[model samples]
Target: MPHARTAPALSLPIQDARERLRVLIRDLAVVRGRVVLSSGAEADHYVDLRRITLHHEAAPLVGRVMLDLLQREGLVPGIEAVGGLTLGADPVATSILHASAADPALASLNAFVVRKANKAHGLQRRIEGPEVAGRRVVAVEDTSTTGGSVLTACEALSQAGADIAAVAVIVHRADASRAAVEAAGHRYLAAYDISELEI
Candidate 1:
């Protein structure tokens, strides 16, 4: 029998992924008019992440890029599970799960979704995962401004006794997030930064 071909490792330039993501944002996602940011700053354009996450083509591409980033940052070797705050982390986490599932070498990493709060009844558990305790985890997000959301998710994971390996996002808006993640002693990775978007 012919030797089975090894699956090729996926890779992409950080800049190229940013440009492609912008194209997807412009073509598929709607851009709201200029609006003030929570930081009291004026902005010319708005990026609705849902546009990319919900798009048929863009969503999968996002998954690939995110998985690629994890590999690029060297966190893939340490991560046992991937997840973050719900709604935003939902798609990315699912994508990571899919990529891992398709590759036997990567299949060891499981995916989970973190709830903003615990369930009202039954388990009343704050986390739902396949025994993430003591496991290394990387929290995924669509965007990060002040890192509050990511921090909250990290707190939850810490409470559950999971070591937060890193925080990876589709976009990193400011330096504050980088500082916070690093200050917390976790690796931080992003597919794009605000300046890279050329906005």
Candidate 2:
């Protein structure tokens, strides 16, 4: 009889995963030029986090780092699920759940996505995926400038009966985001802050 293959390790060293993400963000995501942000503010530098979060190699790294932040920090006890706003946050939420499959120590987390607006037809839902009602959820975003996007999702998820436990972002470009999220009563965490990306 053939021997069963062992499952690979689900979690990496938190610092190593964070370092990998830091390098990936600096190399592949930073774009130097004037660009309009999601908040409609013009900025000289734009960090295109999707470039990293959506990449084949970096996406997994992003998920690992973020899960480490949430799981290891004891920030949101009993967080049963994770989610974020559509488009920017889709990958982060998905990746973390995917990565969790390998780690027996972590609870399997469900992923939900909040739409920019409610769909006009079908279920006509503002939020999609597993029912988040009463679920402790950690919301993530790709890049946060003014915290508007995460706030939008949080409000919707909250209304849907989800306990918005905490918020995480792959790239935090300004203190405004941290302040805004914290003010809303959710501890804000980041894989890489703006100052860390200044290279």
Candidate 3:
């Protein structure tokens, strides 16, 4: 009889990762005052996750934590690609790709970006990088408010023929993004909700 195969278990301590992320977010990403989101929604507080995702100290932490979350939560089974809207999802996706490349147990995953719209020239592609056709993917974002950015990215990915496995983000600012994502029939993961932050 053939034995059943299983995924390699995740062993990292998520609480430690959370503490590190919490400090990094508090010190570098959290800002007070009103700002308009990419969704055109106004907010009294802003979590500029790029502040951490782009950092030397925090970027790796974000990647490790996110990958850990995916693995621990059993969200990694079918995902072959990771990415979302250009700027926000860029670093997070890169981090996961790099980390996966170094880890033996994790599947080698490709990263991709979704343009807000198709380019006018060249390939005129809406989703750029490796081909996503027929692959399972997870849409990543630096922060979320209305979830509009992640949803748009996923829509493009789906149109490009990728099956969305889940949505991941550095911070969840409100309920809308989560609701919107789940309502679309995909699982969602957030490293930290706004309530977890000091600001």
Candidate that scores best on lDDT: 3
Please report how far candidate 1 places residue 64 from its true position, in Å. 1.3
Return the top candidate by TM-score.
2
lDDT tens digits, residue span 88-159, model 1: 787888777776765567646788878999999998877787777989889888877778788788888999
Collision pairs in model 2? none
Pick by lDDT: 2 or 3, better one? 3
Candidate 1 Cα misplacement greater than 4 A, ranges: 1-19, 29-32, 36-42
Worst 10 residues of 1 by lDDT: 5-14
Clashes of 3: 0
- lDDT tens string, model 2, 1-199? 9755422224557676778678878989999999898788899988988898788777888778888788777843378888888999999999888877656767778888899999999999999999999888888898788899999999999899988878898877889889999988888888777889865
lDDT of residue 198 for candidate 3:
77
Ranking by TM-score: 2, 3, 1
Query: Which residue pairs show collisions in model 1?
Result: none
**Candidate 2: segments with Cα more than 4 A from true spot:** 1-12, 75-77
* Alpha carbon lDDT of each predicted model: 0.76, 0.83, 0.84
